[model samples]
Target: MASKTSAISASLLVAGALAAPSASPADNDGRRARGEAALARITGAEGRTVVESIRRTSPELGDWIVDFAYGDVFSRPGVALCTRELATVAALTALGNAQPQLKVHVEGALNVGCKPDEIVEIIMQMAVYAGFPSALNGIAAAREVFEKKGVRTTAMEAAQPVAPAR
Candidate 1:
């Protein structure tokens, strides 16, 4: 049963990621500009901060996140942002080992209009398939995410550009 659900989830993710319009060299600049803007709109200010931190830690990863994940995958037109985040939250919960990422998506879910109870029920439903431990951990992570909204990812502080002397 769990395997079936996992397969279904995987299929949905793949389906959601179907190719978008091709990007030309000339269009790359425009697409990227639009991607960045869309990323900002969906993720909100806190997400931008985390993206900056991610960029500092891993330039390639950060680019893929903003460019591919948020820019391309997320900006895909078929699904609305709320639905997308719900899928993300469900997938993370089903994995039973993605608490940290779950927290972020849970917050993203809220940013995109999912209410707290809705999120609670989402994870609560996972308790059966994923087991109590995974659900507990996910709930805990969600609590922490709600308590504190911003991130200071590893090396982000160190990588911060220092201000010029006055």
Candidate 2:
């Protein structure tokens, strides 16, 4: 019985080792390509502008954005791009201090086929976890992005103050 257990453990160890991804130059190149493609798919024409702006201040940071954030993480399979963008929006909203990034992700979410209302829903959902203030700020950012794109949503109407009964 012990011998059988040892054999099974050895097999499992070998399987785990085989399943792990090895870092090679070719693998890195592939990851970079996939990441760039994913970023381009999400950001469209704005990708260059975004990366260039980041590069002007921190080139390494810019590369990591493209290579790690986009490439290693965003390019992974399973979750849809639209879902990923929404998740990003949610995370940024929860952070409450990344308005610029939140706005950019709001735009990215729109680009990836997320409806304005869906963006609103995600921001509103963040309120439960991140508090009313964070949700309010996030919704405001989403509203700005929507307005810039000439898109309208129920969230926009919600942003307006109600008049008291005369």
Each candidate's root-mean-square deviation in Å? 15.4, 6.9
Instruction: Write down the TM-score of every candidate.
Output: 0.65, 0.76
Per-residue lDDT tens digits for candidate 2, residues 1-166, read 9999999999999999999987753267687787788888888778768898998999878878888888888998999999999999999999999999899899999998999999999999999999999999998898898889999887566687789999
The candidate that achieves the highest TM-score relative to the unseen native structure: 2
Model-by-model lDDT, in order? 0.75, 0.89
Residue pairs clashing, model 1: none
Lowest lDDT sum, 10 consecutive residues, model 2, at 22-31
lDDT of 2: 0.89
TM-score of 2: 0.76
